[model samples]
Target chain A: MEDIIVRYISRIIVPFVQLYGLYVILHGHLSPGGGFSGGAIFAASMILYALSFNLSAGTKKLSHDVSSVLESGGALIFAGMGLLAVLLGTNFLGNRAAGFPLGIPGNLFSGGAIMVITFGVGIKVASTMITLFYSLIEGEGHSHD
Target chain B: MSAAAHLPALTVVVPLFFAYLMPLLARWRKSWCAATTLAVLAFTFFSSLYLANRVMSSGPFVYHMGGWAPPWGIEFYVDYLAVFTALTISGIGLPVIVYGIKDLPHELKEGVLGWYYTLYLLLMASMLGMALTNDLFNLFVFVEICAIASCAIISIKESRECVEAAFKYLVLSAVGSGCLLLAIALIYMVTGHLNFTFLAATLPGVMAVYPKNILAALALLMVGLGVKAALFPLHVWLPDAHSSAPSPSSAVLSGLVIKIYAVAMIKLLYKVFPATFAGMAPVMAMLLWMSTLAIIIGSMFAIVQEDIKKMLAYSSIAQIGYVFLGVGLASHNALLGGILHIFNHAMMKAMLFLAAGAFIYATGVRKLSQLKGIGVTMPVPAGAFAIGAMAMVGIPVTNGFWSKWYLALGALDAGKPLFAAVVLVSSLLNGIYYLPIIVNAFFSKPEGAVAKPGRLPAVMTGTLVVLGAGCIIFGIFPSLVLGLVSRATRLLLGL
Candidate 1:
């Protein structure tokens, strides 16, 4: 990963890939590509950065501890949304029935808790991917084979 | 809907929420992981009991997710059978976690303890989800979660054998999951419904038009669940995985985990598939014969295992066959026996595994031959093992007898005397393998590590005691659980 050209190109492209991931996650409720795909896209950027740089560099960028906390935090966000419905005396994951503002139908922040849940899933999946890559690389060692 | 209506969702969601928090808790407060797991499993247990009570008092009901009525959204159907399976899961699960609190740290690294709890809770939630979910796709999701968690627990030990065993299990389990997904797709294609009630309603009409598709789905469903359940022939993955896992993991894997698949299969076979369709395909007859082979062969293999845990793993295959035998017999008594065996075998196997764990913990002895006169030194674990062994042999006073009795009676009821003989021969095989260990432990002289066994934690000893007592108590008073078992049987048989 000492190749200057590869590292420089990845550094330039990573931001754009992440921005696209965010865009997909934000528009998830209104569009086809939701949390899972968007999250994978974002994770791909991080993986690319790691591959282009090095494992130690990747750990510095997203540290195992941070990625792990984000992993748990992301899922908590999703579950918390569902629990909010239960607390509100509706069924679990109840969207409109829980009386949260859905905002304008076609706009950002629309679709009530779904957008938030999607955002949470985005975080969960991205962090999970990064953590998996870091552990697999670190645990298995960086061998060409 | 009232707060009580939310019980089904809460039962699954609570554990999942706690599971996500476990690794963080491990980092911040390592001690909290075990206590939190115990508390979460306890909550699951009591809620399942409450659900069971409500079902018994009134009848079955459905809880829709997000207030979206199904055939459109996921639903939790809280019926006699659902509650029965849920109660079995949480009831057995709680005790296993209690045993694991003391057992896990001894086997696993200090840092990964939190991760173990996370996997444990996820496994708990998924099994409970599998029990209650009314939709086929939802069942598949839960099945996958259960499959993944079970494999992780095995591999978490990080030993060579553990890793290899887990890999074998993962491959077979993934194949099973694929078969299950394809079966669901087939069912969905013909019925245009994923909800169990809707599928059951529509399947009969579709059965006439799509005979081949329906039959293929049935075969795929059986093979998929059977592999997970370790129903002979397809059970090559079970012995290695179960034997190599840590004691508490072994207890749960052999005890509650595999049985859940059998429960799922029972639900699909009895509820989703029409009786006429089952009759047309000879599914029950096939189950009967396959179970017969599992019983005979699993025991024969068990009789030869030198490792105590491996023996117990093979024994689990045989014990599960009893449950399937009951299901296959299609007699009211036999089905009752099969369902009851699920509970009975879970307790016995868990107790046996924990006792085996205690032995290994104290003396570093796993081979049955090295365990001479272990009873003389470690009375508590040895006594529990004795109780479990007696249960496995289906002694008159143990809980195992009632299920075996019902299975045999059911065989007679179904006019299959040969299966009754199979039951008798299996019991003899059970006694042949299990009795010697007890006799040798009690009568032979203590030697080497057995002479001065290390101390067992009070909590570990306490769990074994409780499970052993449960075996005898439930054995003596079959009425305690029979009410639910009989009712579930009647409903499934459409009596």
Candidate 2:
């Protein structure tokens, strides 16, 4: 949209939206929201930015190529963490018994590999959302911008 | 535990790990996509072999996920049946993907090629997971994965027909998934356990109290899995989805994907449900009647189809009936015949589809009439098609005969000579449809496009050769697979 008010508001509000998403992802083990929800929330900020501006501006911010790489990388990281447990002589995706230090139960870093997995999932979900949106829009006969 | 203790998990995980990497590799190292896929599938194949060897030597074993025990944690049970299924999937999947290596670029867009590999690997991992998983929820998860991946592969061709067929498959498959989830919920309500072993142990106790719920669950399970397995009347989505798909996809879907659900159904029916349950008779009878219909109708439909893949797709519905008929018969030799048919049919169908793909790739023709004298120009694919046709007809010395032999024997053993007659009639039907294709290809003179086709890829032809050989070799030595299938039969029958 060409309107000043909408762009101004989105510019100011987007960063905080991203911050909340990160909070949810980091605290996934301690609280309710985890990778999927947090990542969707994170992606919403970018989607808002894209909506307020033009497709070109959105593409400039996160190109399709970069988003795809991020998508694959996120899943790879998740699988990699599980493989790490297997390498540690524990089962695939083994948690506390795999010898990672479990901080206080309610602490931010206490869930061993859970937080990391959530982080990977969050990144994956976010990029996947962006890619999905972009592809759908691209598939249309004309770009709105 | 040693690293050797991890083969079961590794068989699935390795493919999943590579699937994630496929798109990335496709972008930066475009050439690596197919090679990486091959390598990943090769790993799955060999590991499946290793697990089969281990299961044969030591009997069945279970592996706990994340070091947690079952009833709480997910577990993979490597029984003779599971290993047999795993072996069949990986064995056939490896060659199909090998064929896809050359065939895919011709069918799909340049950008989606990497994603195709991703979908193929995901499908592979999910089928392996379906085979080994002992948890109800885990099985559901794998089933969904397999469903989505299979659909994606079909629609990746991006043709109008492909997209339409995929949508139909997606809708029907989703309904099937919902039914399965509800059935699992019902089972959990009564038994209070998601693990197969725990469910089996507690189900009998609850059966006397909640007979209706148990029966409802059984009915839903049968319909749910039945739809996915494309059992008879529920197979509306299969022909379009399988035929419109890329050839490699057709090979996998008709060859292995549908069979996995049948394996899942067999597991639930034989392992979890108490054999002496009061409702067993009606269920088996229902299965017997449904399969009889599927066999006859599927073959009759095949006879009328002008499109080659469509005909093959219809035939699959019939072939799957043989597996179910064996299960429905509920005798030792019957179940043996059913289980053996799985391996035999997988080889035959995969080879046939690949051979069909080879023809389309070269001649760009799909009509049955136009394939005349195809044997003269494209000897390898045409010859492969001939062998596949013979196998389909249950001609002696082809693998198809042995399964039919057992099914017929099993029917007689079960005191149901009628189904044996049905088996014979279906074989005749099979010959009626399939034999004409061979005779026309080999005996008739070539015309326009069929006269001189494009060059066939070595890899594609080579895959056909291997699959065709597999049909004959396994036929000549039924004992090779019979040992496992019989053991699986004994285990299922609790003999």
Candidate 3:
């Protein structure tokens, strides 16, 4: 039954579901869903794929290397956003009036610090969730043939 | 315009960001790996020193995050105490990593070695983060990270006892974190602000308006931090956990982790809470009594222990009591003495743990009695250990003496000369247990021992020598670290 879900639903649903997750992340600054919520949703897409395929197959597709890089890149980008504020002669994490347009308050790119922080949270949640999934998989002694 | 204002946040970020980077670089060679960690720690250590110097020259450095300024965003405030903990964290952290480089091969296999370094860096980063963060909420987050990392590292050996110890640590820490979060949430309910300084600003209004809830939050916060600090009765898990972990981790956990929590408690007391509380003295007196008992009882426990590392682990509980006693007394000089002792103890304890690691590596013995004659063969490590023990026992010339001197003086200043007397007696007890190994190793020979020190590696001795030098330098020139402590203590006492 699990295999059937993997073969039938996941193969078809994974792509669209992940795209939706991305939408949740990008729209986080404008709406309710931000980095953590979107990242969790994105992870749900991959996790479903893993459930359908076996652990090794799932891991191979979403490898440790990818997760690590994503994690580091996400954090670096978060920090870079802060540095950008600093370079603009504002405070270290000052977002508004530091060059980037704050946009309208109710719009998509509305809140200054909120948007950048959302992206930071997005990267962190995505990579860390994946890492957690991998560790749990590895810890369960996932050495299937 | 000065760096002091932002120093607190940067102190946390540098190590923390390094922590996140380290695991990704895990596949690198051991030498390069150790070098990278050392470089990060050294960077952090210097930044702390620089910040401390700046704060001393200027005053408390306050950075309002996101430019929202205080009461809205978090306030990263660096006075003397925060800077002192920053220095202590990186100060001992670098040596532990240095000492770990030589001892790693023996404790861990090549495949999983990288994990050790990653977790070690995370532990360092978290401590630094916890030390410097001004947001009550952020402190909880960092404490969780430190807890998970330290728990993971403690069990790196895969031994049954290690697992059990780590498990105990995890459960207790979870409880502690829950209490801490609950308290912070309560504070938020009252003031709707998460920044400590902001909370302090509004606490009186909140308290005068609603006394019961504020007092309840205070109680919760104290209990939460008390468990983490391992205050006397709350310290059941510390000795076993410290003793069971591998050597370098044992050093970091004993010498740094609990002290940082104590610093946090000190911050909460003087910085956030109004000292004019009706029950302040009795509460402090309770802490004073508990810490005093912890010292004497901890030392007494140490005397009976045969396992060398276990003895030292118990000794740490006692030494921590001294710091607590000093701080709990509430006198300016007493607090200074306590804070200064945190630095002094880190150096001396790190030296002893590293030397123990060296001896463990060479002669393959851990019991103090079994280690009878290895000192004759391995003079450098033995000598290093002796110096550490002497410093720990409060010998007149060592750095440990200065902290003890200050503690004793502070105790006298607190008008409880008996506390000073207790410290003096405890120092003697410290000598009684710790001095024997040195004497036995050097002066009296044992029946069965290693023929000679079997190629004691340059790296091993190098770390030991550096720590030993720290003990001497800090001992003789107590003023060096005290300069940083006074600024911190001044803020804490509002003097």
Candidate 4:
């Protein structure tokens, strides 16, 4: 973990990795990659940072409490969007009938709630991966002590 | 736009919606998380009741998810059987959550209780979804959700044994999921459909053309669900998982979660497979033998267990056998008995587990031998456990009696008197294991100084009392449940 070349390389690479993850998540409606893969890509960047630096550095970037909140927030966003349709007197998760403006199909904002849901999912998956990594690694240290 | 039309979707979504909010609410106020969970489950319980009423009065009701019609999109199908199963799930869930409020703090470490509640709600939602969904793929997805949530709850205690048990349960259940996914894939390959009704309509023709493929799918589905349901030989993972889990988790996993898979299996056999296929395959005969073994062997194992929870876990394996026996008999009375047993067992087992949890919470004694004369000290839970045991033994005027009666009658109706004998002998075996626990708890001398019973929370005691009273209420007024079971049986038999 103390190797200079590896740390320097990861420091340079992590930002681009994270940018690509955001791009995949935002463009999910128009392309194949979506929330799950994008979220994994973003999580991988944090994991790389943890590997190059120490666990404490990783925690400084995304603390446990914040990651937990983000995890729940993502799920809430998805469920809230679904409930909006029910509140609007359509079926649960009914998209078109919920009165959200559906833009042109090929555009970034075209799919209305789909894009919102994918964004929520992206946040959730990324946070979940980080949280899981922290717990497993932190648990290992505790057991050793 | 009728409110009734949305009940099916709401029954599942309401609990799921709350589950998502649980962690956030816990971050704000831990008590709010528990309150939200209980409130949503209570709502789901009533929604299931209203849906059951609608199904009874107006026949089956179907809700297309997102307004997409079936054969393409997911559908929520609420038949007599589905509503009955959903009602049992949400009904049991409400009380378990109420019981959990007092019991969980003892079982879980600080700071992780929210996640436990989250998993609990998710488990309930997925079980309800599994019971109600008409799409084969949707059912598989729900099964996976239930599997993961159930495993997480088991490991929540964070003891070495709990973690090990959860790992074993995960691996075995993952295998079961694989089998189920493969079976669904095969069925879809043959018919190009995943909706149950559409598959049922198309399956007869596909079976006629490719009998072997249909049979393979049936076998895989049975084995897959059988593992999840802990059907006798496939139940090795169940005892450790159920006994080592935190009390309410054990209660839900043993009491309600295992039963839903059986319900799914029954739905598939009766609704999807044609009578000709059932007759040709010897599937019923195979189930008949497997269940008979499950009954005798599961009880025999229970008889030797020292740990009370392990004994109860083994008893679940036996009780599940009775349900499958009813299904395997495939007669009007037997199928009715099997379906009814699902409801009855849920009540009795959840009561027993919660009562056991109360006992553990009070005295921290889990061994039956250590429980000597403790019943005299802790009378309420002991009394409830007595009722559960009596119900397990099929005593007259207890709920278990009626299910066994119908199952025996079913065996007779099916011209299988040997199976009736098996049922009788199994009841006697049930008496052997259960009677001792009751007797030892009340009558035997305390081995050491009798530990004074600690005060139990009202919510915990109240849920036990209600479930205990339910055992007798349902037993005395069998008509309350018989009407639904008969209708469900008739639907299954196409009568």
Candidate 5:
């Protein structure tokens, strides 16, 4: 990882990779790309950063504690949304029946709880990937640094 | 809007919601995390009871997720069978959680307790979902969730052996999940429906046209669920994973988790497959032979094990054989016996594991040799273990006796006296392994310095007592569970 040229190139490219992931996550309902792929793409940016920099740098960027909290928080948000439907006197995870506003079709906010769920999933997946990578790498010595 | 209508969804969502909060609560207060977990499982237990009562009285109730109707949306179908299985799962889950409150701290590392509770709740929810879902795809999803959660909980022990066992379980179970998904895909390809009812309705026509495809689908589903259920040949992972897991996890894994897949398998055979197809297929006969081998061979393996947990783990494989044997016979009485075994085995096995855990917690002894006369020191757990052992041996007036009696009768009814003989021989085999442990625990004198029984937790001791009593109560009043099993079996047989 001491290759300066490779590091420089990754520094230039990582943000774009992350932006594309965001685009995919945001447009998940409108198109094929959604939470899983977008989250993976975002995770790839972090992984690339770790490779270019070092394991410690990656840990500094997204510590284990932060990632764990985010992972649980994403799941909680999804479950909480489902509970909202129940509290609203409908079945769990009910959308329109739960009184979530469905906006115009093909719009960003059109899918009611779908968009919210996708957002939660995206966060969850991205954090999970980073956490998994960090933990796996942590076992091996960061001798290169 | 009524709470009754919400029961189906709430049964699963309640556990999941609390599981999501577990880690955070653990961070705030460790005791709060355990309390919440117990509360969540208790809620699931009551909801399942209410749902089961409703199903029995009013017939099946289907709740479509997100207000969408079935054939297009995920549905929770609570029939006598589904609710019956759900009640067993949540009912067993509550006591195991109560036991875990005292037992887990000894097994898991300090910081991982929250994650353990979290995974435990998730496993319970997935099992409930597996029981309740009418959609094949949703069932597969729940199966994967249970598999992953179960593996994670096993690995939570942080021992090298625990991690290795968990990995083996993961790889094998992943293969099982893949096979299941492929089978569902094949079925969907032909029927163009994933909902069990819709598939059942259309399957006869499809089977008439493409018998081989249907058979292949059936075979794949059997092997897939067979691995998950720990049906003899595919059960290489069960002993290691169950024995190495933390005791409460082991109790759940051996007692309730494996049986849920068996329940799913029964649903597929009797409900999804057309009656004619089910009757004609040699799958049941094949299952009969495999289970016969499972019964004899699994018992033989159990007989030689020195480690008590490993012995019990092997015994589970054999007990699972009896359930499959019932399925294979496909007679009304045999099916009833099998269904009853599901509940009976859950109680006995959970009690046995918790008692084993208490022994470990009190004296740190896992080998049968070391257990010698330790019963004198810890009378309650030893007494519970003895009751569980008697039940395992199919002693009269124990719950296990009734199931075996009906299964033997079913074999006779099916004109298979040889299989009835097999059941009898297996009971003897069960006695050979189980009785010695109880006898040794109570009678044999300790060879070395006897470790004084440590202060066993009240909750842990109480769980064992309740389950031990359950073994006898259900044995005497088999009528309580038999009514449900008979109704479920009648439905399965389309009688």
Candidate 6:
């Protein structure tokens, strides 16, 4: 099935999918698609890239080391956000009580903890996807047999 | 920041963050993995102790995660009950790592060591998280993490049986996790809260409003956790996985992992289920009777096993039965004894596994029959095993004895002298299986008995000695542990 349609779709759809993934991530704080959903989209974008190309070629673009670091960094950032409250003379993860400006509840960038937790959930999701991809890529040709 | 809200988070995050940082750092230096694990464990131990102290002096400590503040947010209760569980996880866990350093590399294949530590730390973190979590959903999450990681660890050796056994463990445990998740969702739907304390407030109303939901959720939770905990009928996964896994993983799995799940069960019965649970008194009796069966059946099963590890694995079910029986009684002291056994068993049984591994390390022996002449050759490990054997049989001057004594006392307290007698009888049965190993080791002489050894490596030998010594120390120093346990039980029972 490696025909003209495959070439054309890969040419046009891949960039759009990738761009849409970026849009989801950036617009997470404002809309229904926050960190976890957006991060999943980001991972799916890479996976689509891999499926179009091969595993090694795709991983070359999305490195394992960088992904693991992102995973760890994401978790750390999430935890660090919580710990920041402790440093700020409030309790740990005291999002609203520590005053992150809970703007109009229905508006974008509202709900202080919602944003922080969203970001954290995003990082965790992104990292997990990356790690999974790495494992899949690294063990591409290996067989239990 | 009433101190209740953060203790659980600290217990979890200290180990979790460390576990996360560990392999990342181990990417640079391998020794640093072991060193970092110990340091993180030390930090967790101290934090748990501090939580225990607060629980003892102040009362149960409650912490809300993300400061969304429970019902809406995850909560951890660092009561004496939780602190005690956390302490057991760390206390037993630290020594396991110490033993694993030389011993595990010897037992497992290459390309798996880093993953081993990853799974180990994850195991420790999950147990810690499970023990401390007050939110049912959070507890379920930690339990799944523990189950997955533990199952992975079980098959780390790449043995054919290990693979099949781990697969069995995986499928059953995944089912159990699904049941637990379903239970959590059911509870949340009924109680409108995932936080345990909130559930405590709301459960009575929910139980009244939706009695069917109450039973369904509690039953599902029990089935899920019982499988995870390896209680009676649900315990089919334990023996194969425990025996087939590498020694260190076996030690952790048999020693403390199951009891942490039992503690979760305790939370369900006493805290969340309560009046509804008592209303289901028939179920409790069924649990008690089955635990009695577990004690009888597990000890008998242990006697027949030729593989040294298999014998110890069966012994674990029996030892766990004592905890289940005590908790099953659900009386104050009975529950205390069950809770107390968690720490006691963790120390004593893991000591047995480590000592067993030492033999496996030096002589490459796996079966009990093969070890007839082993005592003559490997005196220290054999001696350590003998001490562990005696401890397992609940001999006085070992920690096992005290927990069994408490359990017996608890049975008597519950006006069930027959069950107390059973507890006593199980000890004898424990002796029946374990004593032969000692006698055969120290006395019997098989062919080609070569007594050439200083000791297993210090990491290995030292861990066994310390744990064997701990079995004695904790036994002798009963008041220290009992005080913490009684306070912990008081917290659990809300006295």
Question: What Cα-based lDDT does every candidate model obtain?
Answer: 0.94, 0.93, 0.81, 0.91, 0.90, 0.80
Q: Give the DockQ of candidate 1.
A: 0.76
| C-alpha lDDT (0 to 100) for residue B240 of candidate 3 | 81
lDDT tens digits, residue span B384-452, model 6: 788888877888888888888888888888888888898888989988988888898889875442344
Docking quality band of candidate 5, CAPRI definitions:
medium
The digit string of per-residue lDDT tens for model 3 on B140-173 reads 8888898889898888877888899999988998
lDDT of 1 by residue, B1-495 (tens): 677779999999999999999989998998988899999999999999999999999998999999999978998999888898899889988888898888888999988899999999999999999999999999999999999999999999999999999999999999999999999999999889999999999999999899889989989999999999999889999999999999999999999999999999999999999877787788999999999999999999999999999999999999999989998999999999999999999999999999999999999999999999999999999999999999999998899999999999999999999999999899999999999999999999999999999999999999999999999999999999999999999998889
The model with the greater lDDT, 3 or 5, is 5
Query: Over the stretch B247-320, how does candidate 4's per-residue lDDT look in tens digits?
Result: 89989999999999999999898888887788789998988888999999999999999998999999999999
User: Which residue runs does candidate 1 get wrong by more than 4 Å?
Assistant: A142-145
TM-score of chain A of each: 0.94, 0.94, 0.84, 0.97, 0.94, 0.78
Q: Against the true structure, what is model 3's DockQ? A: 0.47
lDDT of 4 at B464: 94
Give the worst 10-residue stretch by lDDT in candidate 4 chain B. B445-454
Candidate 4, which segments miss by more than 4 Å at Cα? B2-4, B447-451
User: All predictions: root-mean-square deviation over Cα?
Assistant: 1.2, 1.5, 2.5, 1.4, 1.6, 2.5
Q: What TM-score describes the B chain of model 5?
A: 0.99
Model 2 C-alpha RMSD to native: 1.5
DockQ category of candidate 4: medium
TM-score of every model? Answer: 0.99, 0.98, 0.93, 0.98, 0.98, 0.93
Better of 3 and 4 by lDDT: 4
- The reply for model 6, stretches above 4 Å from the true place, is A1-4, A98-117, A137-140, B1-7, B276-280, B446-455
Q: Which candidate is the best by lDDT?
A: 1
True contacts kept of 6: 0.28
Candidate 5 structure quality by residue, lDDT tens digits, B367-450: 887888867888899999999989988998899998999899999999999988988998999899888888888888765533
Q: Kindly report which residue pairs in candidate 5 clash with one another.
A: none
Candidate 5 has an interface RMSD (Å) of 1.0
lDDT of 3: 0.81
Q: What is the TM-score of chain B alone in each candidate?
A: 0.99, 0.99, 0.95, 0.99, 0.99, 0.96
